[model samples]
Target: MIEISGKKILVTGGDGFIGSHLVEQLVDAGAIVTALSQYNSFNNWGWLEHTACLEKINIVSGDIRDPHFCRVITKDQDIIFHLAALIAIPYSYIAPQSYVETNITGTLNICQAALENGCDRIIHTSTSEVYGSAQYVPIDEKHPLQPQSPYSASKIGADAIAMSYYNSFGLPLTIVRPFNTYGPRQSARAVIPTIITQIASGRKQIDLGDTSPTRDFTYVSDTCNGFTRIAQSLNTIGKTINLGSNFEISVHDVFHLVAKLMQADVELFTDPVRIRPVRSEVVRLWSNNSLVKSLTGFEPVVSFEEGLQQTIDWFLQPHQLTRYKPGIYNV
Candidate 1:
């Protein structure tokens, strides 16, 4: 079994959703984890601030786009988990160039640093957004990359750059591609949180965009487990693997399920601002999880209903629900 014991690991963007959870799991597995957040004036650690494992990690604040910072922080690290990225598709439309700089160039910096430091492994995080809409059911690693939006295009670029390092310079790295990951501590901008926050805030009318698009949502913890497992698999280096539940659900269906569980009467209204341009929207996403299972013996441990219930309960807390502005259409 892949053991993380005593490994010196650096988690870029460990302050964010999946990254923070990964840090906690890695620490519990006995890895000496270093958590890095984007340098902010307020010194906020994002969700990492609330983690009970906070004291066990070495927290640092710096931007990965800075080459000097990337090189400095990655030095002497045993493994590097690169999770930093500008993930919002709507935001990418407004700032496509920022996505290129952060997603592509920032990734370049990390790969360079990892190679220079002689890091044992570099598990670069990738999103299924790179695959855009599924051209076919059970989209596998070989799926053609359709850049339906600026966000997916940048990730495609970033993934290419990462793999080149392994092919040319022989940098030890594995591309961990996860389908829609959702759970507690996710940003309000994500769909699961968006729906939960609006319902929790007593909004009878929920403002949403197109609800026809289908996504394969994997729980955050399962995605993290995939990363840790990939790191432990020596044969997975210089390869790309997927972490997903191999199931799919459309937005409309997902909303209905959430409403039933919460017993909340919420009406959906399509907001123009929330809808993606027709061509830019990914109409469907279904993951082919066989590769990950074959490689790492990893499968989602949590059922969709169970995970959703846990998520709904977390958002029900007044203090947590208050953190999101349900009325505002978060892009």
Candidate 2:
């Protein structure tokens, strides 16, 4: 393992769900962490605001869409983790321009900043959504990309831009493509949180979209470890690696699982507004994590049921559970 004892690192979306967990882990690894929280009037730092590592991190509030801010934040950093982007699929359909500006252009800004500053490495994040629906089981790194929605298209564009930097200019970088990650601090926008919150709120009926789409879910800590492990290895530079649990479960089954965990008898009510467009919906996503394992010796440590129980425990906390309106559809 490459030692991160005193290295300075920048995380673009450090205040987000997965990013917050990664920041905590990096701090525990003894890195001098700098986190960028999207600028807001109320000075809200998202999930990072409540963390014990808040004081240990150098927090910068800025927009990644702004090239100047990107350059400023990336300067003198040993490494950068570019996790900032617009990710909601339904919102992407209504505001593709926003997605393009943030996901694609924001990545370009970060890459250019990295090049100018001579950063040692960059861990660029990617999503399995780029694969659309899985054409084959255990989708590997070589699986063809199919952008079924504007959100996935923007991610593909961002990945292409980041890879181009590595190919054309020799910018040291790794694209960490994490399949659906779920854990504590996840917002209501995600299915797991949505289900847990509704059931915990004593809702007999739950609102959800299509029930058949399956996804390979990785725990948040495992996904964060994937980022750090890839960044530590020079072999991962200029390559895209997948981080996943290497298994699959349908949304319907997930609902039953959550309901069982909560001991709540809830019925899933299909919400028309919750479903994606027919062609835009990704029916299945299964990850083949051979490349990540071979390259970094990283494997998911949490089981599906264990991770689900942990997530449910977090949401069951009074303050956390009261933060959302479980009666309403998030998107």
lDDT (tens digit, per residue) of candidate 1 on 1-331: 4469999999999999999999999999999999999999999999899999988999999998999999999999999999999999999999999999999999999999999989999999999988987888899999999998899999999999999999999999999999999998999889889888888888898878899999999988999999999999988998899888999999999999999999998898888889999899999999999998998899899999999999999888888887788888766
Candidate 2 segments whose C-alpha is farther than 4 A from its true place:
none
In model 2, pairs of residues that clash are none
Off by over 4 Å in 1: none
Worst 10 residues of 1 by lDDT: 322-331
What's the true lDDT of residue 286 in model 2? 93
Tell me which residue pairs clash in candidate 1.
none
lDDT of 2 at 165: 97
Instruction: Tell me how far candidate 2 lies from the true structure as C-alpha RMSD in angstroms.
Output: 0.7
